[model samples]
Target: MRQFSENTFESLVADTQFIRWAKGEQVADSQKWEEWKKNHSDKTREFDEACKAVRMFSFATPAISDLEVDYLKQKAFDRSKKQRNTLGTVVWMRRLTRVAAVLFIPLLLFTTWTLLDKKQLETTYSSLVENRMDEEISVVAPIGTRTIVDLPDGSKVWLNAGSQLTYPPIFANNGRTVHLEGEAFFEVSKDETPFNVENFGPTIKVYGTEFNVNAYEEEEVVTVALVEGSVSLAKSGGELFLEPGEVSFFDKSSETIHVERKNLEHFLCWREGKFIFRDASLNSILRVLQRQYNVEFELSNPQLGSYPYNATFQNESLEQIFQLLELSAPIQFDYTKGYLNKDGAYVKGKVRIK
Candidate 1:
């Protein structure tokens, strides 16, 4: 009934009750051992180590019968008695070598188990990745709505109004790739794996970069602006590289690409609920407002499209924006309520600017 902390490896191996518990041979002995371990929390680590060693030896040497186990215990006891009587180093060394030879089989098994366990874990992880690659995921930012999403590879994306993003559940084996429909600002994670964003007419590839992509299918132009870091725009004919503060424009109709140096803040401002326009044409500005408010617009004079406007707005109602537009320019707007559809739901309102 020695305390668990005071028990030595040799003592634990010699005890028949401990051996039966370690080998899980007796349910009653296992229950008692578990209770003892719970009461002696400080000795748990040592008890586990000793039990594991005994179990390994028992499994490795399954052919060694109970009679052989008793014979080995007797021999160990006799060696201890001789050491106490004579204290002869040569005799003790010989007996120790014989005991080590008997334990060598378990040591080999332990090494083999360690290697096999590592391989099994690696195989399981690879299988998990392969399974995840076949799964797809998609997120959409509806009209008049903006959203922030976190990608599988720890990248963050701020999706603008009327944008759709499609990607895999887990980016595995090859690289990270996503499809964009409207507008999104990406703060991509830095990694060895390349990240690709495919749009309508161009595919943007990046190592690690923060950039904004505007590829609204309705628009004639697809543009990618680099806020920081570098990106490559791959088109049908050639590939173009972009530096910080540079914008790449791809004309879908002409199948041509061009890059320009401009202030990227203007392009990325929409992600923060701000619409910034610098000398933008009135018609172009109306289109943006239409998308942001999910409203229809009609101009009484097509010549108003030639007028230039510079403005910045944040979280403003449609009436407030129109009021500012009226004050800044010689224009008037008639706002009308929308009509109900077949399902009896009112659609978006229309605005007439003259």
Candidate 2:
């Protein structure tokens, strides 16, 4: 719902998703908003100001309404309208002076509504905005856990460990779009509107297709592995289409994409709670292991980062997985048990590999 392109206050306020985005309710851009701010420096100031305005504004009508009182007020307005239409200016001006105090009760609203046929103009717009904000949703999969999310369009997503997925409330009514970080396997439901998966900077477009996108914040590249159906990954300056059983790697620095036809199993094995690696480099394996095991790894021998290895692990403890890694390569790791920090939360088991 990109409703506005200009940075003017009026335009920013008019954006369809502006209120949610500004109030931190929209997870699409808010996930990587600082990076977006850095990239779009010229508009950051205006964006910040708009957010402040949205945060400060709220519509809370005074709680003083009665059916009987409202009916009486409507009668008064009707009577005044009829009298003003028939009276001379002098008589109308005298009546206005007499009723000025009562009219000023609502701070000029009486005068404004009187000339406009006595109608309140704000109720419709407020309800529309409230409904849109209430519909926006965000789902998160914490470290060492996975979640299966069912979107409004009947699209199913297997959100990987330590990942998040967010979709606007208007998803089913309008376009099929979701924002993703880390990784997810998507089984998009077929529809006339295309399904778009927006990651850090690239967007994956598909129609009734199943695909896997790995775009972790700490990963070196954005990876898209199509399981079935066609998809296109569009980055800043280029777009690459992929057929079934194809994978594309987008390098962030060079903004280049490399495509390869590899066994889709390795890219999707995690969906079944299995880590299957075939000649994956030592560094790549460790990266996956870290996310899967919720551990931190430091390589004493940086040269070993690229050492090729093969392995499959499922339902194994972190220690057992380390033992398997040692058996595959000339590598031994020292494990440090995790501890609860000041926040009273256990996090980040540390491992040193040599």
Candidate 3:
């Protein structure tokens, strides 16, 4: 207290006890300061200047209406009266201090809300940038092989033989998209954004669904079968919706699509290493076998291509498959071993059906 009497203006304003008395908080300290002033009449001018400076240097806040300021002033006065009987010199000196406190409350709340909103905006923008920076990746199920893939979006894909898939390392914010070549079965995860599969000429869109898509480039038609859930097939100028156990066929030449109810198990059986045919033509069955075994076929009789066949073969070797076909149909197969090329590498063999 004695040191404060001889202190400079800046030091007195910075003192915690002095600030408390200036703001009418420390009643005991205020009484002590009054006694000190009486003993040191010569420093009265300096003490008054320090108090005035502290009050004038209050923090800035948003403007309050005249009516609001008066309301706050009245509230402060009423609260202060309940605490003390007389409005003494301390209250008179710190009248402006109480008003500043009232105004600062709203400003503090506004500042906190503004900071939180800005942080949320920055986080959303960072997520978008991260997705855009992600690189594209591709996976292939080569001929005679199948592959199972887990996507970044928690979806699972079973790629059939001779199929290719291309996607991003990380999915974009808006949705997930992938490119497909031959055939695949997708068990898509449920999400707000739609999952899109782009084939040769058609696009399949779904939210959460189990479906099979066969869009081989060489085939004249693209097939989509929904084993469970719903899917939307979009083509050049139209779209077709499919429910569970329904199939969609899109013709490339006519640019038309047809939807029909069918046994989805037939389309999805290849995912489980099963070959199922229900009165399918011999040509179509041979094409499926060629892709599955990575072998070429030569039909000695062109008329045999239209012969209808029905069979279900699971985990069957090529030789066993050919034997089954010969027994079931009027056809005989001859196998020929391929010769080595100039590089001394043996080429693939062929099976001819007569």
Measured by TM-score, the strongest candidate is 1
lDDT of 2: 0.82
Estimate the overall C-alpha local distance difference test score of candidate 3.
Answer: 0.85
Better of 1 and 3 by TM-score: 1
- What's the candidate order when arranged by decreasing lDDT? 1, 3, 2
lDDT (Cα, tens digit) per residue for candidate 2, span 78-114 = 9998877778777878888879977677868866677
Better of 1 and 2 by TM-score: 1
The Cα local distance difference test for each model comes to: 0.86, 0.82, 0.85
List residue ranges in candidate 3 displaced over 4 A: 1-135, 337-346
lDDT of 1: 0.86
| Per-candidate clashes, comma-separated | 0, 0, 0
- Candidate that beats the other on lDDT, 1 or 2, i.e. the better one: 1
lDDT of 3 by residue, 36-124 (tens): 66886877777788877777767677888999999999999898987675556668658878888888999999999899889988886
Extract clashing residue pairs from model 3: none
Clash total of candidate 2: 0
Q: Which portions of model 2 miss their true places by more than 4 Å?
A: 1-130, 133-135, 172-174, 236-238, 341-343
Compared with the true structure, what per-residue lDDT tens digits does model 1 show for residues 1-354? Answer: 445554555666677898888887855556787887798677777778889887787645457789989999999999999877676777688899889987988998998998899899888777767776666788999888999999988999999898999999778747899999999999999988889999996899985579999999887789899988989998665778899999988899998888999988889989778999989888878878877888899989999987999999988988999999999999998998678999999688999888
